[model samples]
Target: MSGATSTGDVLTINGTGLFVDDRGPKDAPTLLFVHGGPGQGSYDFMHAQGDRLAERLRVVGVDQRGVLRSDPLPSGAPLNVQVLLEDFEALRQALDVDSWTILGHSAGGGYAIRYAHQHPASVRAAIYDCPCWDSDGTDRYRLPIAADLLERYGELEAARRCRELAAKPERLDPDDQSWGAMRALGKRYNELFFHQPDNTDALDRIGSQSGLTEDQWRRGVSHLPLLTEMYESKQHLLPELSQPSLLVHGRHDLVVPPDDVQAFRDSVPNGRVHTFERSGHFAYIEEPDEYAAVVTDFVVSAHR
Candidate 1:
């Protein structure tokens, strides 16, 4: 598979290291893709979209800090909003791109918004797909929409478990229970969020390809409670971002809820939102052609 041959190259930031896999022509307008998951690295799902996107612009998918193929995060680094923002800056600097567009998915949207807010100068435009930003660090953003899915699909137990974990923030760390919870969440996330329920296999494939151990995946998920704070605070951060942006979500997305996405679109000063009727959380993977075309057009149109 073309995906297997695409090895990530290394870049150093703050004397620590990071990894990124590049596709498309060097001269094309750079599109930096931020993959979801504080733990999920840039996988083939993102890579598969490359040729289609590269036809219009350059694309680089980054496996952000502590994820597979990236440098181990610094021992004491807080793994909070500030650190991630800084890492993005470091990435831009290391890549020597004067400006770039960003496309963020799921948790990636939160980071992209934060980075755009903090470094408006470096961004040309941004795309937020199924963003999970709420005011507080709770899964309330997901609950109302996912309620039926949680109840009908027998995921209520898992949903409640996730909520319980969120309620007890201190429980987020590498442990058997936390790992187990993430696995369950991943299974449900695939079914509840993606158009095709089978895409959950992509995560497993990516995990294997990226060489992430079960421990790393679990540890990465354990931080979701801490990270969801950033996910939920769209208003404060979105208003601060001056970059041109596009927000797309699946109408059927029980994960982030299209309502939340629409609300965010109305509020962002220079933003637009598109809904994918057939998709859920993984719209890009589910509706790659439309997703890529809309994003490519948007980014190129916004490029100065």
Candidate 2:
């Protein structure tokens, strides 16, 4: 039972050791959390809602390969959508899980949708929380608000840059994105993630949680170049989803557009939308109680 139920266990899949925190009763319905930021770890979600959800669901949060708790990708090796999906499949097989309910947050939504499409039999249901289903949609809707915030925060130059980027052709090449301008948005960028600009205590609490080495802490820096692949992939699958899906979006979310979330819901064959009226990008952190209730309710009732 050492590795079976341990909160911190490493599963070596495809020769890379992926960190997995598996909790709750083994026989309960399993829910695997797929984190975003391309290579961001699942610790944030685990720290925020792991215990609450684990009581009635098998909460498994595995930091994607090359991210926080997992092994970093080898130099010169490509890390793309297919590789991530294969990794998840391998991890599932390693855990002896026949299937799982996937909960994808932010950019993880792209991967979740693709995983459900590719392995329909392996996904009982999916929960997309504040999902960034399409990068185009994200920039189209998020940038204007971000620009306004930047201007309000007195970062005029960055605000001008955001306005410029947001006005470009909708399908402009990914290379054309002004990441430097975005970087210039600086600390003001954090305001975009919450309904209450000052309510970002969760970010600090989650980022500073112990147990990761220094190298693991910075794995996302190595993944910056691979995010274009995630963006391109998410743009195509909303129309094809046929499973019972719950799309949760924060009403005041400036990270991913709320309207875009609704559009995604309308496109899916059996998709439903739940808006977190008082939350922003991180609904779980902003409105923890309601977030727990909705997600748990969906997991328990979605397949029935």
Specify the highest-lDDT model's number: 2
**Candidate 2 local lDDT, 1-304, one digit each (tens):** 1233336777888878788998888888888999888677888888889999988888889888888766677898777878888988888888898888899998788788889999988898998877766776677677777778778778898888778888986663467565456656676566678777667556765676655567878987766765686457364587787678888878887656756666776688888889899988889888888998898888888645
lDDT of the candidates, in the order given: 0.68, 0.78
Give the per-residue lDDT digits (tens) of candidate 1, residues 1-304.
0124345576776565566777777777899988766566676545558778888888888766776666666556667766667887788887778899988877778778887877889998998877656523325444343444565667677657655655664423333243344345444645655666667566556557766566555545534544545534565676666878888877667546545665677678898888887776777777889988888889889885
Model 2 TM-score on a 0 to 1 scale: 0.92
- For model 2, the run of ten residues with the poorest summed lDDT: 1-10
Error of 1 at 66 (Å): 1.7
Count of backbone clashes, every candidate in sequence: 3, 0
lDDT of 1 at 287: 80
Checking candidate 1 for backbone clashes, the offending pairs are 133-231, 134-232, 193-281
**Clashing residue pairs found in predicted model 2:** none
